[model samples]
Target: MTNYRNETDWERADRNIGELLQELRIAIPGVQVLFAFLLAVPFQQRFAQVTDFQQSVYFATLLLAAASTMLLILPTAFHRLTFRKQQKERMLKLSNRSTIAGLLCLSLALIGATVLVTDFLYGSEATAVVGGASAMAFMVLWLVIPLRARRLG
Candidate 1:
């Protein structure tokens, strides 16, 4: 097993930052697709016919998707802006924080996608059940699994 305590702080921070970037790579595509779909909804013929509550839900979902996408992408932009500044340690810490923000955004985006799909397919009742389940799963994957892995591994 690797001796984490023996590693320099910068080494540990670099590893953490790398892991975060990998996670964002997985998350970004999904969020982009969702955001694209949300953007197109307003252009659809049936968009105006959607109920007010559904419209509100759709708007909220779109916003969350947008925010998530931004959060996930911010670290890359930040790194580029700070490149050659000898700030790897600071960059790593900021990247990790951005990653946490991105995860929260991702959870919200997933819930929003679930809600948008379910509401379109059935109604609020079914949407609640489906979206709630998806939210729970996101929580487990984003929060529980990582915590457990870090603890056990």
Candidate 2:
């Protein structure tokens, strides 16, 4: 509804895809590193010393990272499948949704990782503070700010 450029729908879709892919390029590396770290965690000797709660958090965080990775990569796969099929608009819609969901998952994974580390290094008290702060920061920075800006614009 908000036209930033005087371009046709197809042109807009193409540009949106380009911008989305660029954003994904920025996000994918962090997700990969987090996922890799999660994957290698259980193999570490100290992993055996983790509390059951930590283990549960680790599993959830790993799954979140994996889901983020898949959702982030899905746009490219969708693009490939729809390539030259005159479905740019549809692709753009799916890509936009997938990217948003991917970012949400990534934020939750990062928060979980923070909580796990804080709990492991300190205790439940410190973990509670850090985890709450981390979640609030992500929510404000990633979700609230963007939505507020969008509404204002």
Candidate 3:
């Protein structure tokens, strides 16, 4: 890289970390809220009436949300542990991977949640259509468009 902005390595790392943290700030709360809701689902009286498939989906979605929460918050922990150790580059690399994986988990969790709700409300017939559509929307909006934009740029 040509250091187009004339920033030192440390400066670049700092900038990247700042940007990543900002992105996480936007994502963290949503995942947290979803995780909270998932945590409470089984406590609801009606939850006992869910089909086996719905139960499976619910568990998987809950796990996905938990994974997303951990991955999304990992950078902060890493930063805290590695602070002042001149590990910004490593932190940045790890944070980038963590963020991507976190977002993937979050997307899948959202899809699962949607499918679960749709199935509960309108049965498997509607769930099939709505779930597929939800998955497609997330994939296109979150993954395809960004990849395409990067390729084009």
Candidate 4:
């Protein structure tokens, strides 16, 4: 039993950070691709023909993807800045906070993408329907399910 637990707070913190980094690795690539797509949209020929609402959605999606990219990359910066220090516990705590923030940004990015895609295809009503559904699904999977599992398990 004693062997199953961390010997020190630092070890526990390191383990926590390791778990967070693994999760972020999974999230970062998708956001990076989304951000890249958003970055390229303005240069497309059809961009100028989009409606005002769609243009707004495009800008918002770009910003959300940018924010998510930053959030997802925060752990690496945090670790680099704190290298050779004895602050693993603090770093891990900060990284955990950053991960939560990143996930929120990711959720927003997904919602924005859904809005942009649906708007491009079927207009505002379709945008609302798809975006709302995607956001709800994200909330349930990223938040509710995790909380329930943590509490029950």
Candidate 5:
């Protein structure tokens, strides 16, 4: 049932850690970009013209993006803190979970931010249509596809 090459425990742990680190390298930058954009939103002149709902959506999106950034970066800190403790396996496992959680937060943040922007440009009905579609896209791409792959494989 194993689709991967068989290896010793240490080898597997090393490989997993390496893979996690590489993945973090991809995730961290994207999360930081979202965080930076969200951080700058309030300073925009049009921000003050936002309706109450839009402001709420913006804040929610910002908070989720911030949380995602923290979660995405935690694995690096966790690895550093736990280095030389002979706990690479634990680190890998925990970081994997953290990455998943971070991704979920990121998806939500993207959905809310998209909705806020779309609503600003269009209207509430347009926001609902665009946001719903965007959320579904993320859910399918991020969650459903991965889960289905794991289940089928």
Candidate 6:
């Protein structure tokens, strides 16, 4: 009970939902871009040049992107269907989990796509370096900072 939010249950739920929706808004655009890019890759001429492993990575990344997009979108659908159902608490919790799952899929998708391209253009060594850096970037920006804030706030 850290008094971080001095709101009543309903007020907190409303605020949490608002914050979650805002987070989704910020996340959705980038996910959409990644999703669209992945969708278009198979149509590109260079797509045929990728190795078997690269193709596998491509397919996995594409599926992850699609899943991420759906998970991100599910929150809104959940909200709409349950808006007046007096289940804000349950809805918020589930939506929060969905958002986290969406982010995890999006992170892996981004790393996989980046590694695939790097492996194609550079090699496996460069792909490893780039993949590590990209994962660290997400781990820091998306995860560490929030955790630090939670601890310090």
In order, the Cα lDDT scores of the candidates are 0.82, 0.95, 0.96, 0.84, 0.90, 0.92
Q: How many residue pairs clash (N, CA or C atoms closer than 3 angstroms) in each of the candidate models, in the order given?
A: 0, 0, 0, 0, 0, 0
Model 1 agreement with the true structure over 21-48: per-residue lDDT tens digits: 7888888898888889889989999887
* Order of candidate numbers by TM-score, starting with the best: 3, 2, 5, 4, 6, 1
Model 2 earns a TM-score of 0.96
Highest TM-score against the true fold, candidate: 3
Residue-wise C-alpha lDDT for candidate 6, range 1-153, written one tens digit per residue: 234677777888888889998999899999999999999999999888989999999999999999999999998888798878998999888898999999999999999999999999999999999999999999999899999999998
- List, residue by residue over 12-123, the lDDT tens digit for candidate 4: 6667777887888799999988888889989999888899888888888788888888877887998899898877777777877877888798788879878887888898
Per-residue error (Å), model 6, residue 123:
1.4
lDDT of 2 by residue, 40-112 (tens): 9999999999999999999999999999999999998998987899988888888899999999999999999
Quote each prediction's TM-score: 0.85, 0.96, 0.97, 0.92, 0.94, 0.91
Error of 3 at 26 (Å): 0.3
- Compared with the true structure, what per-residue lDDT tens digits does model 3 show for residues 99-144? 9999999999999999999999999999999999999999899999
Clashing pairs in 5: none
RMSD of each: 2.8, 1.7, 1.1, 1.9, 2.1, 2.2
Alpha carbon RMSD to native, model 3: 1.1
Error of 1 at 127 (Å): 1.4
After superposition of all CA atoms, the RMSD between model 1 and the true structure is: 2.8
TM-score of decoy 4:
0.92
Candidate 5, residues 1-153, lDDT tens digits: the string is: 243677778888888888888988888888888889999999999999999999999999999999998888888898889889998878888888999999899989989989999999998999999999998999899989989999999
